[model samples]
Target: MASEDLKTIIENLQKKGKMAFLEKTTPEKIEAFEKENAVTLPEKYKAWLLYSDGGELFLPAGVQFYGIEHKPLLNVNCEDRPSDDYVVIGALASGDPILFKKNSEEVAIYNLEGGKIEEDEKYSDFDAFLIDLPSGILGIGE
Candidate 1:
């Protein structure tokens, strides 16, 4: 889906009261975050951050996103995730994390506990990932 489509999706969700924004981060802040982490945030993911920073989704879909994080805790928070190469962008209620490669926009699901790869899915970019979020897990589905 295009960026406009994503906006419409978010707008539609907002009308249903399932959208919430964590905070908005400035370009300088996000750039600082990238410098601190020594990784470049994917363009699409960065746009998502500049759009809403991050927040939660419920009802039709459920995810607590770790966006650019409006505060100064982006580095610390990302480091707290399971792996260094996989940044936890969002997660399911089961605690499985939805990760994105540090240097790539590609997305994936890595089960931390069971150590099993349930989906083995990959998306070219963050937009594709969001537009095609799978259903039936942690309340998010097709």
Candidate 2:
């Protein structure tokens, strides 16, 4: 999705009472997380984290943004690092992974049910992913 589209999506979620990320995690924590992972977060994602450490957006298909302390990619454990070539970041309500490559910056959906990776170049980054995702799981929509 385009930048403006992303903004509109976020705003829509907010208007619908689905977006609620409050400022929580600290910069030091975020820094440690990055250092531990050995990856630099993109600017938009980094800024969102700084703005709202982490929170949930409810839409029945609720999406949870991993907080500095939550480890959204590492499955709630910073020790469980994902393999190279792909890094796990967030997940669908169904527990499927949302991953991306370092250089590409494109986010892909991984199906836990099929053990398959699906990449259609649909989402380019964190913001885009959030905005482009389906309204939500069953019963979680506008």
Candidate 3:
């Protein structure tokens, strides 16, 4: 779905009093974050961050959408991540990371299985991933 649709979803959730969001951040701050982290964020994801730096979805399932900031509550620099190629943008209630490739829009879920990190699921892009988020959380999609 498009960013507009995502905004609608968030708005509807907000009307229902089911969402919690952080203050919107500036493009300059986002750019500085990219430079400091040595990673380029996807354009669409950046758009979402501009909407709300970070937030929590309380319905369907709890999801933490991380922000590009140093504040512990909004930070996305997950040091225990699997690799430098991936950055954890959000996480599931189960503690599984929702990762995005550095400088790319590709998103995936990295799960710990058999003592190794494995791609449990993958999405072609950030938008597709966000579109399916609720269904994925409800166990209604692959």
Clash pairs, model 2 backbone: 59-140, 60-140, 61-137
User: Residue 25 error for model 3, in Å?
Assistant: 0.6
Candidate 1, residue 102: CA error in Å? 2.0
User: Local error of candidate 3 at 119, Å?
Assistant: 6.2
Give all TM-scores, in the order shown.
Answer: 0.74, 0.68, 0.77
Regions of candidate 1 where Cα sits further than 4 Å from its true position: 1-3, 12-17, 59-61, 71-83, 116-120, 134-142
Report how far residue 126 has shifted in candidate 1, in Å: 1.5
lDDT of 2: 0.60
Which clashing pairs does model 1 show? Answer: 134-141, 135-140, 135-141, 135-142
Scored by TM-score, the top model is 3
**What RMSD does each model have against the real structure?**
3.7, 4.5, 3.8
Rank candidates by lDDT, best first.
Answer: 3, 1, 2
Best by lDDT: 3
Reference-based TM-score, model 2: 0.68
Residues 55-140 of candidate 2 have per-residue lDDT tens digits of 66765566666666654434323222244666666666777766666656666666666666655524777777765554532233
lDDT of 3: 0.70
**lDDT for each residue of candidate 3 in 1-142, tens digit (9 for 90 to 100):** 2367768766645554366777888899989988876778888778888887877776546677888662334345676467777888887777787778776788877774432355447777766776666665435433
Cα lDDT of all candidates, in order? 0.65, 0.60, 0.70
Task: Itemize residue pairs with steric clashes in candidate 3.
Answer: none
